[model samples]
Target: MNLVLGIDGGGTSCRAALATLAGDIIGRGKSGPANIMTDLTGARHNIVEAARLAFVDAGKDSTMISATDAVLGLAGTNVGGYRQQLEAVLPFRRSLVESDAVIALNGALGERDGAIAIIGTGSIFMSRKGAAMQTIGGWGFMLGDLGGGARIGRDLLQEVLVAHDDIRPGSELTHAVMAHFGGDPREIVKFAAASKPADFGNFAPLVFDFAARGDSVGSRVIARAVGDVEEALDALKLEPDQILCLLGGLAALIAPQLSHRYRMMLRPPLQDALGGAVSMAARLFGAPKGGADG
Candidate 1:
């Protein structure tokens, strides 16, 4: 029987699903981070590990990996060179590499034309109309991803520093952050110097939690992040009736914070990035004759 694999790799984790070419999923697996740009070797390892586990769960031979077609929607693929490098290393009969935002758009909108804002450790806004697709942000944490969890956590740390130096009024949120570092400013500096986006993103939920409880610093930080997200959405030039889906870990928390006008356009996704990858793979590689649906 013909099989296909769908992968959704992000900064936080990598997920894989084994399915028949007809679109029925047979098994699923998950592994650690797989952001190619940040950690190529690790991403490659995790991708293969996830695929191998999926095959095992499906009760198929591990060697069948070479016979399966795959579609991967991953973070950091938008940057130059990373996709090519990953494609060269991937073991599959056929494969497609796409930006995480593209898969999210596909999953959220299906056959309809619409927009999506993905906010997790990173953020990207995408819109599609027929064959044309446009994107904003998602330049990675350092260069962009302004409304992402990583950025929000980074800003929280900055606020902690400011409060330490008496530049800003300290709040319960800042106090909790300082406590996390043992109340030592130098420790925060040390952490920041060595930390990756995911490390910073670990603090994102705390920021949202504090914001929800009316902490001034947390409210200010989230407000800024929400503003940036709205600005990116505005740049999409969406139609009045076009639906917008908010996707990823931070989506639910950020949804209520968006302006009422934009909130009205928001809708839940029909599927997720992994499902979108499976759908794409099914389109690219048809099911074998007489093969079961899954």
Candidate 2:
């Protein structure tokens, strides 16, 4: 039997699933962060680890990895050179690499034309109209990803610093952040100098939690993030009936904060990125030439 492998590699974790050519899932596995741009070595290791674990869970020999066709939906695949480097090292007979946003859109909408906004440790907006596709944002943490968890957490830290300097009134949220850093501004500075986006993203849930509790600074931070998300959605120019799925770890937390107009357009995803990878793999390798699978 020909086996297919599907991978969803993100800033925070990597997931792998093993399935038959017929699309019945046999097993799934998970591993640590696999963002190619941020940590290439770690990404490579985790991808292999997740795949191996999936095979193990499926009662297959690890050596079968080289015979499996793989489809990877990964963050940073759109960045220069990273895809090529990662592809060169992937342990599969054949592989396809696509942006995480692409898989999110595919899984959310299936064969239908629609849009998806993925907001996690990073953010991106993707839409498909007939045969045409468009993407916005997802330029990584430094340049874009405005409404993402990392950006929200970064903004929270900045607010905390301002509050510490008496430029803004301190609140429970700011005090908690300060306490997390041992109430030493110098420690926060040192951490920021060495931290990655995932590190900053670790604080994102706190922002949402505090916002839900009516903390002033936390509410402001969430509102600003929502505005950025809305700006990206507006730029997509979606049709009135196009289904919009908010995806990623922060999707549920952020959805309620969006404007009423956007909320009205929102719909739940049909599947997830890993499932889309599997569907792509089947399309690429499971059927005969000239068939609908491709």
Candidate 3:
């Protein structure tokens, strides 16, 4: 009958869930972006609001949640500054802060030893060893996010601009990107300046579409993305038999194009990232506040 709360802070939305100690979900909730680096105030508001809604969905109150453990897996909280900022708000009997990648890795592998390759707004590879951890990539959406949606979208935009200027071979993506930007090339510049990683990532589906229609540019884009992610995976020091789980948008889209050798290395996860928050909460039920249990 022990109650626990799990929070998954996505780039565009924040999701919260209430579950029993044994893992049966009781309720769910949601809010806006909780990426502290991108939007700190919005991040705190989203986390608090989502937690409130989750409690309401569970027919509980804040007091109950204050007694039960709450674990928040937030995006863009990779650094200590943002972590401390989040630590100042949010209610919990015990709470722990870590990057969203850590939660994704836990959600997939649980306590088991494995590696995770996440390709969403950003891309990162993480591996767990008992209680120890290691990572590669995760350099953020700006400089590095190779193989992520933002990267793909940036490449697509470049291709479209080149096509408009007659500097590259023509393809369906040219039209799609043009249409996506409302047929104005200047809109592309504005979009890049204003869009977040997830915003640009929204264009990834179009990349898949063009590739499916036999456009070499789109095909090459997909291949390049998959290859970049593979490089991240290969950098991990996992044993030959260790299973790697692929998370996020790009991984799911490009699975068909992945080689059998890579396929053999993958392990499908039983639960999504919210499950990781749940697991963390369970372990922290009796731990001191502000300490990590996993």
C-alpha TM-scores of all predictions? 0.86, 0.86, 0.86
lDDT of 2 by residue, 99-183 (tens): 8878778878887888999998989999899989999998878889999999998899999999999998989999999998899
The local lDDT score (0 to 100) that residue 245 gets in candidate 2 is 97
Model 2 pairs whose backbones collide? none
Q: Cα lDDT of all candidates, in order?
A: 0.88, 0.88, 0.80
How far off is residue 156 in model 3, in Å? 1.5
Runs in model 3 lying further than 4 Å from the true structure? 38-42, 175-187, 286-294
What would the per-residue lDDT of candidate 3 be over residues 76-134, giving only the tens digit for each residue? 67666888877777666666777788878888988789888887778888988887788
lDDT of 1 at 222: 93
Per-residue accuracy of model 1 over 76-102 as CA lDDT, tens digit each: 786799999999888887778888878
Estimate the overall C-alpha local distance difference test score of candidate 3: 0.80
For model 2, the stretches where C-alpha displacement exceeds 4 angstroms are: 11-13, 31-35, 38-49, 60-64, 89-91, 179-183, 290-294
Candidate 3 positional error at 294, Å: 8.7
